[model samples]
Target: MLKKSLISVLCLSLLVPAVSLAETATHAVKPLTAHQERMKTCNADAKGKKGEERKAFMKSCLKGESAAAVKKAPEAKKHEKKTAKKPKTYKKLNSQQMRMKTCNVEAKGKKGAERKAFMKSCLSNK
Candidate 1:
């Protein structure tokens, strides 16, 4: 009975890994969603663009806008340049950056070891 149980346990251990691998393999190649397909097509079309032009092209293409319209967008932008607003004023900051900024502002008057201790405490509290 001991021999038979040990043999069965080994077989189960071997089969467990095989079954898990098969399950993972089956899930690895899922079909893309409709929106993913659209994005794929738009990305391919906008492959040559860079910076804000690429962003604008991707936005328009994903929104079901005609590629022709987006292609001629540069000319329209030329005319609108006079009325176009300035670039964004505030930058997007992550939590760590915001914490650092606040810490720096608070530690403005301090120097050397004092500033280091203040920053260390401030960073940890946040």
Candidate 2:
């Protein structure tokens, strides 16, 4: 009976530490909330700033009023204007035009049958 109790106690001692360690590991790995993440970002951005500058930056950042946020409004407007402008559409060349352009490039030095054969094959491939 005494030996059994001792063995049980030993097993419990090992199990208790393992359970506590797991609990601690889980708690330690808990993800930060949105607010916490924003704060961390603001803190990093405020690294070079100090005193009133840091305080003001943190306040504006936390309030979502930083320069990036303000600049985005104008940038978004510019983007809208750019997108509002119609894109230029180009007319595709016809098969004859494409063949002429390719033949002109390929037949730069050649003449007679070679140029004719190249032009024929080039036009045929298309």
- Each prediction's whole-model lDDT (CA): 0.90, 0.80
Which model scores highest in TM-score?
1
* 41-114 per-residue lDDT for model 1 (tens digits): 99999888998788778888999988788887766777798788888799899999999999999999999999
RMSD of 2: 13.0
Tens digits of per-residue lDDT for model 2 on 7-28? 9999999999999999999999
Alpha-carbon TM-score of each model against the true structure: 0.48, 0.44
Give the worst 10-residue stretch by lDDT in candidate 1. Answer: 70-79
**lDDT score, residue 37, model 2?**
94
Q: What is the Cα-based lDDT of residue 20 in candidate 2?
A: 94
Query: Which candidate number would show the highest lDDT if scored against the true structure?
Result: 1
Q: Which stretches of model 1 miss by more than 4 angstroms?
A: 1-13, 74-126
